[model samples]
Target: MECLTVKQVADIKGCSQQYIRKIIGQGKITAIEAEEPINHRIQYLIPVETLPEDLRQKYYASIATDGPPVPKEKAVKKEKAKAKKPFEAYTKKEREEIMQWCEILEIWQKKRNHFESKVEGDRNVVGYLKCEYPDKQISVDILYRKYAAYKAGDFGGLLDGRGGWNRGKSAVPEVLFLQFLYFYLDDRQPAVSVCYRATVDAAKELYPEMVAQFPSEQSFRRKLKKEVPEAVVRYMRLGEKECFDKAAPYIERWYDDTEANDVWIADNHTWDVMVMRDDGSEVVHRMYLTAFLDAKSGVLTGWNVTDNPCSDSTIFALRHGILRHGIPKVCYFDNGTEFLTYDIAGRGHRTRKSQRDVPKPETILAKLGIEMKNAIVRNAKAKPIERTFSTLKEHISKLMTGYCGGKPSERPESLKRQLKNGSIPVDSEFREIIDTLIEGQYNQEPYGGTEKAYQGMTRLEVWNESIQNTIQRIASEDDLNLMLMRTTRYQKVKRNGVCIEIAGEKLWYSNADTWQHVGDEVYVRYDPTDLKTVRVYDVEDRFLYTCQVEPALLLNFIEDDKAALADANEIVRSRKKAIRNYAKGITDRLPAEYKIDMLDLSIRKAKLAREGVNIAQSSVIEPIRIDPVKETDHLQELPMASGADNVVSIDIERMNARAEMRKRNKRR
Candidate 1:
């Protein structure tokens, strides 16, 4: 009698080889072991008669051949041709259905032999399968057909072939569909009906013959929904930013992976409630809240409310947070002009075309050793502070007076009345309300995050617990105030010191060292909150000195109050001393051999002139003669001449006149 190996039996039984081996080991199926070991292992062959009759038929049919049965394992490989679609190409639900069918076939193969006929066995199997899977409807005819196909081509035959050829494709003409897409996929985001009408009009004008064959508007809508992915639709219609925010897969940050102060995120939100301006005018404006949130604990560590978002507000908010929660190692910020300013994140941090000659000054984050990371532009979902703002809008802003809605459409009907009636809170009152809500309500509320370890704990509680073992980097108030000062602006040192404009007033800050830098352009950083002193740095960002406010000059010049006069004199004396010291320093560096005697140089020049070695005359003024010439005795002793012609030589006046004329001509 013919026998089948375990593998062949498993193939015929539509089950795994291990299942057959297990059944044989349990003595459920009769098997004969080979007397000789094959390849260091005993081999078993089960008689064909022992299998279920249906399985026995399949086993014989699989091995039937014209001359000799060919082994399935040793079958010749086909020559390479067009690649077939992989099994993974099927949808998830389709693949699962195929697997279920395979399992049903395997069960049917094992149980068929217990019945008298194949039909009865199939009926019973269907009934059992139906009971086992109440959600699925099992049919005996379909099962028989599937089994026959499976026997012919194994697993591939079970795949659903309906609609496989043209899946995700449409029957509409390509040109017509392209025209429809041109109208539909626009940034303006026209409605489906409008796009359909536009497409029809274009088709009627451009392709008049094909207009009748065009699909209906409803068909176009269905095709669009079926063919285009949601992300692609958003990208084409709404905007790339919206597409990324709504449909893009994002990284999930695990809060437990970091300590409480390890990372912080900051953002600015426009509060929904309007508040009266502090200028005492009858005008109201919406307030902006700049806040820093501890990413791990979801706590609002610090925040500031202002009429608008600016670098000052951002810096003040950061200072508040750092003062209370200690410095964070990493700070996440968005690409806002305020956050990306040179004072916060440093120059050229996330910008283009930075000045090459200018040195990148140290920023607040750099000074405090905090790593500043910028989030993707327009990606609000990445910042936890945005969620905090949302909570504020919902729980806090709605309860306040003059609460305008988030958008114009959502504005309450009574908001205009409230504005006219002057029911809005003042700026200070609004700030107080914000502080109360953030500290007393938001941070103190229980954490609503996916981290199981912090479920029952409040944000503040979690923050405190996480930071129990952490070594926080704390800065003194003086140091923090200096670091958080505004960005350095180019200022030329005046005669007094450097003049900077603060709060619409020009203030002069003078330092003893500034005298040397007079008329030199330097960078100045000053705390707006404290304008008493300003820090100075050279062009290379090297710290020079801290300059104090120059004292006001005394108006009482007649009075004997010499305190102000003394201060002025002291500044002048310091400046003069600085100049003298600088000059002396230069002279001290000179060698004695390089010094020359002025008188000796003049004598050498005169000696060169006497030697007739043509030397250039000095540009210096000639010295006056020290010795006086005595009156000549020739004038006193008359020279007697016998003739009057000889006495003509006594005309000294004409001789002196000629000499004076020659001197005047030489001078001219």
Candidate 2:
């Protein structure tokens, strides 16, 4: 291969030297950088032998042609890499939201006339934006940025990270903030400002240098509201009740395969109505309504309207439910004193080591093999009875004549205006009203949460569907008597009969078969509401007799006069005994120095004649006595002190000593 200078190539090819130099510059022909003495400067030359065959042919052919192909268009230069945008760092959801904003902006831009036509009143695009997202308050400026980003790179460009430097990050001392949060989460949950101030103060004490880094109260609040999760905030501010009811993770808890009588929830409700006493007199009294509902069926198994709620009242409600639907597998109760009583929980007293006489409810439920369960305190959602009560009050109770609203603020407008004027039905009338509502309305109405299987079915209907398969535990007559009866322990029998005094009234139980056992001990049981007769059980736990109200003194003869006469005679007997004891005490404490005259016929006659007093004479012998010493005008007088300074202090040391007698009189 032989090398050739650029000038020779140009001469052979019949082209200018500059044209050949241009081809070499374009690298179409082989070229090497070298120094040329002719121009005394650095230059490049081509070798004819090393030239590409195509280019060599083109050079020879161009000599034959008019001119070499015009230099191809200058090679296009590569574009510098596109600059990365700030929005590229945004999260996926953030990008999505931005894209949605971009869509709205695009719509606003494309249909400007249509959007303007839809705008009403004095508002513009903002009103349209509000219409689009009724919940969110989007602004035009926010949409402008979104549109710019969208135009730049579509969805990816819509993402933005501006003004988010402080996001998900806090400057406030975390330990101090948590301490303050815990303080607010307590039962006394304080205000937000209070918690903030507490945190600031604590930060000052614990880490003074970091106090300056703490954000403003408003900024801190925004951070908490935006960055902190709702459940975390609720747990800190509202305590467990709110956490469990509102913020806790939801769990679907259905009975699954449970039947109607599988579980029963019981609770006591204070009714909104004001019922009067049975005496036809209006009174300011509220009635308590204790009720039981089948958990599975939502049926009103039993309910009772009473003046007060106690263990007995709770048992009454339970008994009513049991009689109607049989015994349940479990009785779910609230943390009320009535429901938490020993009777239902079957808790034995620490002082009473023996379970000789357990509460009737506990005993009966145990015998029936039923269990009791209590819901967490203050957690109303755990028990469905709360919802039932709410439904009842809203739908039924509010329509009643004397419906006192649940709260003072919820009182009816009519009731508020005429506070003093309201219809308070008598006890019997109120009872009837309650019975009608429970039986006819509550039970017969469809439950709000009825399953698809039982849709449109009344609670009673659902209950009836499963009632046949239920395990029925019915109480016998004797069992009912024993369970419902209130017991009085340590009662003794008296000669008149097995005398038992109740509320200061003596009651007697006498049977031809057991009258001879008058001096025995007995346990009495009866109904507090109806005290006409009391059942007596002997020491051997055998049924002895039924005691009737016996008035100690027969001052009146009438049926149903048990309490009135018995109470009167008790007062008479109490007064006589008190008088006798008082007289005996005075006689025994009489002064030994004085020769007392118990009776004097001359003095008595003179006093009677002088006073002109009459006495009722009795066919009884009277004893007369004379004074051992005659009355004298002179008598020794003891000095009296007017003040504490002049008073003398008596000392027991100066008293005479008595002997310890060996012989003693035994008195029964």
Candidate 3:
């Protein structure tokens, strides 16, 4: 009537309870629950009904299913049990058709996944999606009608042109497009390879304007840079359940943190027109503006309007905001492509204040844990950033792009012409115009179904109240360097001790005692975002300094520049424009702190072998292996002996990284 506890079973079986629990773990026994013994060992419980009449004989026979164990009788019985569950008992024809459809869907899903994984590889999907769906509307109508007939059972055959569904060739093709929808979460894509067509061709696939049929991965991404919002549309198309499965958890986790500074959103958008021009030329330039939108504020707390939009456009905008308004905890953005990059993943700003090398206009933000969320391919709801940018473009950016004749130096006469057309020039003039026209617009901004509606106040009003008198603590040079430095310390041995001294002890972290750790070869990792603590693991054959600080830190020690990684991980990881510029120097002068002022130092890199600006390994990064923990010989604490064992053997071999860096420095 009652289930047998693991201890009871173990007692009867004359074995330790752990052995009984292991049997359950290996699926040898079915269990009701598991418990622990007095020694903290686990015990499993089993129901009496689980035993079969011949179980004892089978157990004694020592059946091994993997080898010479399966008897013919049992094998035949197992085969019958292993048969697949039957499909809804469909008529043979219907079942056959479904199988065909399943095959097609699976193929389509596979092809889509292949393309979505890498930007360049998705050219085929893009090519298909970019074409216009000339007959998509007609196809939908025909498909629906055909589906109706098939449902009613009046059709003679279930097969159509595709030999699966009776739906005729419509504008939409036969591909299942879940993969594209999935990868395009929001507008915050770091970089997207764009394949533009000069002209539409007949063979080119076409997409209808209709929202029902989602665009192939191609069209969605092509227009993404231009379309400020609509990045999350595809995922939303998934039934509510799928949407919940993919996004609800992230949302719940976000709400749980509830820390205002935990997540921040920043983006750049073109602003309203305020006409100004080059020093002398009458050639007009429409100032393409950008903003780092603070989702919390829903305001352009940090914004900039420039003549041309480039890769570094967003970074400059961020700098302007931090120097003036203050640093936001998080910056949200859309897949505008330019805004998303591995460089900006966790970084707040790329330009170091002390760097005299002139900060690279574009820099990697991922070194810091600055929560970056890119909008999905066609969904704007995920990126409130695009919506905010749209408004800014309409009311503010349009003014900045106002037709300007020339700079103030020569445009004195043009001001009269500009005034006739209502052009405001300079920051002060634009400020006045915004004060008069845009002041109340935010209050009137309609937020019907969004969360803002319940909050009552417009984003601006709420943000102003929330931020009133609050001062943000800026990371000083010392603060930043401290954050970047490893908690390690390195010192040479002086006393006749077998152990070597190491630096960065602050970096080593573990529940395991480091004081107990004594090894010649060592590797340690520190959190890039929080450098106070480090994870230390023993070195093996490989070491990489640039591995992202998180998951790679699982082990405490690491080897450097081992041949194994080259055979495996030699390709560039997800890269940013700035890193590409200095990739070569990244390994140069690494291991030692080069001048912090040199943050913006640019090296010429050869891509496909021609030379251009790049990030040199010697300048940006260095790899270091953990130095061995010092050994003491007071003759105590050796597990084997009282204290005579004095082996100075440390296994950590140096990563010829220093030699490589010296070579690079010499070249430079």
Candidate 4:
């Protein structure tokens, strides 16, 4: 009986395939399971004979109007056939030789009358056939059959039985195959041999009858390879990245029509080069560079290098880009904690109470009408800046001294010792080299990824050309300084100044005007790099005053001040270290057999001291909330005894004297 696929019924009914499936689900239309699946998804086919008369008529009418929807079985059969091409059945030489055979047969048929006359004249016809087809062994009857087949179907007839020739049928049942597939296609990537043995064991243990239908290991493997797609194997073995790289179709993302600074992509990268501090110290450190790349022109719009990738570094990089290149229309970045600041990305969910709340990083971008978008997690290809970092690490970083490979697997054998003994470049030198490399070499090189208009031009050239159309939004020096401040504090104005503690160092910020609001909490914003000056704001976030560091605390430069402060910090640190050392030494003095409880006298005393408590001494005076005179209205006079009708007023002075006497007696 003829059957209509779900798609066919859907087309006839003028509905979606899912709707047709819904109709079947609702019992409106009956459907039978298709013999074969489509695209590894199970399908249902509706029998034409079993359909309602009205629906059948409608289907016929659809066929008359638009063509009939292809049947599932036929489509599946075609798909299975197409999986192995017909050309694959024959070798290149065999196919070429077969075509030659067809050509010769055609010639022989056309000149049959001439050949027949030659044969009648007692010429050797067999000898003539043998000489004409010297390379091939062919009889007259075989040639006639070949010629007839060639006439019927051309070249296809020659390769007709080649595809199905001697193909052995598998004894394995579909149910058993599916059961084995579950084990074979697991992400653990078990060996095929193991999977096959395990599958056989499982089958014998679970369903005893199905074990007979199980094919041999070799046959099972062959069928598995043929039935299962390479995509399934890749996904099961190497996971989504491999599957996406190999099996998934690539979708092109075009930004050619976009203007420069319309979209910017930013990401953090730790440079491979070992850079020394600006103080010319022997200590080496890694530099983290946060860079923003223009999506349209592929230019390095803005970048900042610091010792670490923090919200401070990220915001500084953004500010640098915005100040010079103007505000981007869209800012695309990953969901890093550094990027979560409201100053750049904007305030997300409020998780804390607002008490002298400072503006978020996103607030800055919001003012400029820039949209912040986060790239999907684990999807690196979504960010253009990732590729930028990769290129820099590979081509640029490798050329520098004390270059550490990004991954352990990529490091050289001598890298460990070389790193320790190497003369690392100072921060200033590293900065200069990077600037030269980016501007002189990288940006000036022909960039193939640019738009068609910039096909032959360099990235820098393209950017210069594109930026001509953009309105310049250069920030003033004052604005840059204000926007780039990272540290925020809420402290009350004191008589001396506003005392702020950061990294265990106390900095006194003072202005003459701050003395007026001595008790009011002021919002203080300052750059961590420059603590000498802090911008003081009122509770309303309005600029109140610029407070300079106290003359005694301020140094000519930050590094000098840090060095002086570090020495002072060391004194406090040494005291704590000595205390810990003494505690450890006391604990070690105990005998090996001794097992002292943590709540022992010595530990208890130490805990009490740590908590700033003198447990040996006690306080007798605890303040009471109410005074006797204040509670006079609520305090009512009561009878002294149950039998007495006369009410006795409370004697406040006598009662206090008696209470004091009772306390003295209890202490005695």
Best by lDDT: 1
Candidate 2 residues 537-620, lDDT tens each? Answer: 776667877766644444556647777777766755665576566666766575644423333344556778989776878889
Which residue runs does candidate 2 get wrong by more than 4 Å? 1-218, 226-232, 248-254, 327-330, 333-382, 416-419, 449-452, 473-483, 487-515, 518-522, 527-529, 538-541, 553-668
What are the lDDT scores of the predictions, listed in order?
A: 0.80, 0.68, 0.44, 0.72
- Model 3 TM: 0.28
Error of 4 at 70 (Å): 45
* True-structure RMSD for candidate 1: 21.9
Model 1, CA-based lDDT:
0.80
Cα lDDT for residue 221, candidate 1? 84
On TM-score, the stronger of 1 and 3 is 1
Candidate 1 residue lDDT tens string, 284-373: 788899999988888998789988688889888988998999999998888888888876786444555656455656677888899988
Against the true structure, candidate 1 reaches a TM-score of 0.60
lDDT, ranked from best to worst: 1, 4, 2, 3
lDDT of 3 at 195: 16
Q: Is candidate 2 or candidate 3 better by TM-score?
A: 2
lDDT for each residue of candidate 4 in 350-407, tens digit (9 for 90 to 100)? 2256722644322556656778888877788788778888888887999988787887
- In model 2, residue pairs whose N, Cα or C atoms come closer than 3 Å (at least 3 residues apart or on different chains), thus clashing, are none
> Any runs in candidate 1 off by more than 4 Å, and if so which?
1-147, 153-179, 194-215, 343-345, 350-354, 357-362, 377-382, 482-492, 503-506, 511-525, 535-668
Model 4 poorest 10 in a row by lDDT: 76-85
**Pairs in steric clash, model 4:** 342-360, 342-361, 342-362, 343-360, 343-361, 343-362, 344-361, 344-362, 346-362
